[model samples]
Target: MALSEAEWKRRQEEEDAEPAYFGMTWGEFDRLPERKQQETRQRLSQLGATHVGFWKDCTLGKCRRARRCIGFLSEAQYKAGYNAAYPPCARGEEPRRAKIYYDGICRLFPEGDEQPKYDGRRKTGEEDE
Candidate 1:
């Protein structure tokens, strides 16, 4: 996704201010040798934060419909929904967002859709007051 110049500047400033990965800016982290990056990732993976955190962050920020439908679902259930929503991401497209998948998830689970209203009318089976 292409970010506007203002957004890009904001993100750069934010990253510069906050530590990313292991006490370094994301740029610094990226500049590390691939082996070092892999090592850090492996350590983060053992802590159960890398992949899980990434997806949760994505869902909360970018997948509004998917986020709304997340109520009352177990981790496994949510994962199933996510897989159904983002097959390409499941296949191997890690850390990428796609509008198509977002739409797919919304279609698969319409919890975010507006609810219907019922007029205050009595049914035939009910006793009239």
Candidate 2:
């Protein structure tokens, strides 16, 4: 499906700062190169900081900057969502910021399009609530 104009712009803004990945099966991410995979590891590292330490380096100052990050799902998240079964990263690719799949978006998780929340509420008064 075609993305809306605003949606296109938002994706572009995040293209550099916060990492993003299309809905891909785990098998696809596993096949990527090491450098590409390393980016996810870095994001996971930062995710660790948000919980354990007060001081942490911002990988990117803004989600727009983080958009360039290659952060993605490991075995767990992908397995939960993806329909097809695939082996996990066997190259010993370390864990990543499975928490922050998208930068700055802490609560959102990819449960297919159900989580994206693009559609309007069922009723008009629901907008206020």
Q: Evaluated with lDDT, which candidate comes out highest?
A: 1
What is the Cα-based lDDT of residue 127 in candidate 1? Answer: 67
lDDT of predicted model 1? 0.45
Residue 112 CA displacement from its true place in model 1, Å: 21
TM-scores for all candidates: the values are 0.28, 0.26
lDDT of 2 by residue, 1-129 (tens): 999999998876565444344553445556678646555444544343344321233333442244333333355545465311111211122222333333323433334555665766567786668
| Per-residue lDDT value at 87 in model 1 | 24
Q: In model 2, what is the error at residue 101, expressed in angstroms?
A: 16
Q: Give me the runs in candidate 1 sitting further than 4 Å from their true place.
A: 1-10, 49-129
Model 2, global lDDT? 0.41
The per-residue C-alpha lDDT of model 2 at residue 37 equals 56
RMSD of each: 16.3, 14.7
Query: Which stretch of 10 consecutive residues in model 1 shows the poorest summed lDDT?
Result: 83-92
